[model samples]
Target: MAKKKVILFIVEGPTDETSLSTVLNRIFSSSTVKFQVVHGDILTRDFTSTSKIITAVWDLVKGFMGNIYHKNDICRIVHLTDTDGVFVPDKAIIEDKTIRNNAHPYYTETQIRTPKPDSIRERNRRKRNNMGKLQSCRHIAGIPYSMYYFSLNLEHVLHGKTNLSDWDKVHCAEAFDLKYGDDPNGFIIFMQKSSFSVCNDYCASWDFIKVGLNSLNRFSNFGIELPAVSQTR
Candidate 1:
């Protein structure tokens, strides 16, 4: 009568969480599945050492598992990290002793390659450039939607035209929120819609956060109790 738990681990960031959660929910919609997606503060400290990040993820996973595994139920953890500009592997490196390592290689990665200057002034300049492109297009309406599309357009411009496929557009809109500036809902939607949100060919990083929140919504609608990563905690 119990549900199977699928744990999703992510680095700190509302945008990232949204994308992963959305995809997981979309993938596992059956009644037999239960998910526990935790957004961690892996990037809080310097992630220069990959070992530290992996260790932190391991600790979080072990702590999340209570005394439920003995009841013939299994828990799986899927870790999603951002590659940024660095070239990390697409596969997840899991370190659980008992479990077959990376049993389900949902170990995914995203890139954040922004060639523009990191300084506030330069960053603003880059944002302005992207915004201008979005404003020129009329595919969507409303200021909020316009802003959202503009921001994404900027990403596309920086990375080159990504051939915004139908599915990609649908997910992208859901992934990036124009209303909430850095809100994660839109990104989560992107993740749920697209198999992969952010990759080398394209940089749709917002989808992860959007997708994750979507999962939470589905779980709540089904009356399923799940743990949330509270900011205060």
Candidate 2:
């Protein structure tokens, strides 16, 4: 008998699929479990408005195992977006309507505790200018943290330096016009470099993928193989 296939769907971003693939292959190396990971091109601030991407993902998953296997097969779809105070509404739409018909599980999210859209640019610019001063202060204070989170050059709810609480909303990474855009690739790097990325929803999705793949590896039927080449970067 042929082995069953599992489809791992992800939202488009800088987060390398290679990491997920590598982890999956390792867990299922001895098992017959097979997985085909695909990404949905829903990268950007406009992702919430792009209902086409949602429909496309549903169509693909629906065709994979048909409605009959919908409840049986482990097809899954995950989306990561900017919370920007809009995550609740965005997720509600996907859960209640957009992907409600999808046979597989569907999820969406946004960054948490990020600077609001209106202030991200100014904050980044201020951070860039104050890097020298902040680095010096880090030595003096014997603690290292970016001054962007609390600086007069940037906006805040309090005087002198402001923390996360004063902001009215968080902005999507893309809105900052950062070098890497909002893709997981850049987000992953940012997550690696700063404390902020840990709070973001994108990393959470990646972590979940790791968990799902690990679970699937134990089920002895899918033939999973590692990627021929590992990450050099």
Candidate 3:
């Protein structure tokens, strides 16, 4: 029998893998669904720039292949990213001197509060520009590529909460897996019907999140990429 082509998912952290890997595997049973946990937001990473984003993604794909799979063995790359309120205006970023930690930035629907507002602003500027470049990127190193967003962050879109500690993130992902692991169709339905699900059009969904404070709001374009049940098989 021929090996199944891989459908690679590039995600920020392990919790994302924990939450969706099994369900996505079940949904895309015809292909091998694999998760590449990038450990941090590549879009906002200090070493990444708009010019290097595409190559960075391609490098990730190659890293995953790692002599085990050839480039042709991969069918597509689906990148799932947190919006992190990156598209919000500068005024929406408030420097709260009371925030003594200086490293932890907190998000609200209207603003992100932190002691290091300038750092956050710079991160946001880079993220916004990099994401804009990524949005138009249809392929990386000859492999089909598409990107999706969870506004504010994954925990917000998936669990209606944010600022979760690592333990909380794992707990929530496990709980989410328990709910959807055996019901891929149900997962699809939930993605489609959720209040956070953006419109079905891909471009429109990205546009919606970039407008005003919508990036800080609960929204996802992932549902737009979820394959229909019949198509999955």
Candidate 4:
């Protein structure tokens, strides 16, 4: 009876699109929410030296909306990117020590951060500088944008079940189990049945995602309306 929200999921690849769509659809059903996937380009760059996120995201947004236009109909734009090289292990550790650090995979730094730890003042300074450089893409034509980043890459988010040989494709949305990957419907069922909340393994991003989804109209129109909203950060 209520109107559905139009959400544009700007994902880096189809595999992401597949899993996310499947999960969200199970939660919101096919009627109360409509999802449109707009594929984005991953910039070719020496990522260790510089972050090309702004350039890549800008291309995706501008390509869709063009130079000047109002986007009131769109409920929210959720941009997803992976933290692939965020905390690469020291080469010598993997080579000589042969014992890699697990903290690298559990990297919690989402905002601009120094390569190594810094004093509070220094950290703030670098953060400000990075923010200023990124302001152009951060605020885009007044269109609401929220970002979701996967730590250590999407495969790691899949609990290292990255290989295609590990999973089965579900019937509806090509869903794959984020953890096991052997059962394609596992994730979708979990999302649909439970009051889904933040997962520690997801690298502290679930609440941010809730805020983005809340920006939409009637976001709680159907099943599992805004679960774990109270547990949001």
Q: Pick the candidate with the highest TM-score.
A: 3
- Sliding window of 10 residues with minimal summed lDDT for model 1: 215-224
Worst 10 residues of 3 by lDDT: 224-233
Preferred candidate (lDDT higher): 2 or 4: 4
User: In lDDT terms, how accurate is model 1?
Assistant: 0.31
The C-alpha stretches of model 1 lying farther than 4 A from their native spots are 30-53, 63-74, 88-233
Question: Residue 115: error of model 3 in Å?
Answer: 0.3
Q: Tens digits of per-residue lDDT for model 1 on 1-233? A: 55654433333334333333443353343422333344432423333243343444445544545665432333334333322211222111223333232211121123222222133223233333332333233322111111121112222312232334446644554543333234333333432333322322111322322332221111111101122213111
What's the number of clashes in each of the models?
31, 14, 0, 0
On a 0 to 100 scale, what is the lDDT of residue 157 in model 1?
19
Q: Write the per-residue lDDT of candidate 2 for residues 1-233, one digit (tens) a residue.
A: 55453433332322223223444333333422332233422222232233343344444445544655543444333222211122122212222233332322222122212223223333223323233232223211121111111111111111112222313212322223333332334433333333222233322422322232221111110111112222312
Predicted candidate 3 versus true structure: per-residue lDDT over 122-210, tens digit per residue: 99899989989988888888888999998777889889998888999999999999999998888887788899999579888888999
- The better-scoring model by TM-score among 3 and 4 is 3
What does candidate 4's lDDT look like per residue over 124-208, in tens digits? 2333333334333535446556554443334435433322222432322253534424432454344334332233333233333
Quantify how close model 2 is to the true structure by its C-alpha RMSD in Å: 20.2
Worst 10 residues of 2 by lDDT: 217-226
Candidate with better TM-score, 1 vs 3: 3
- Hey, what RMSD does candidate 4 come out at? 10.8
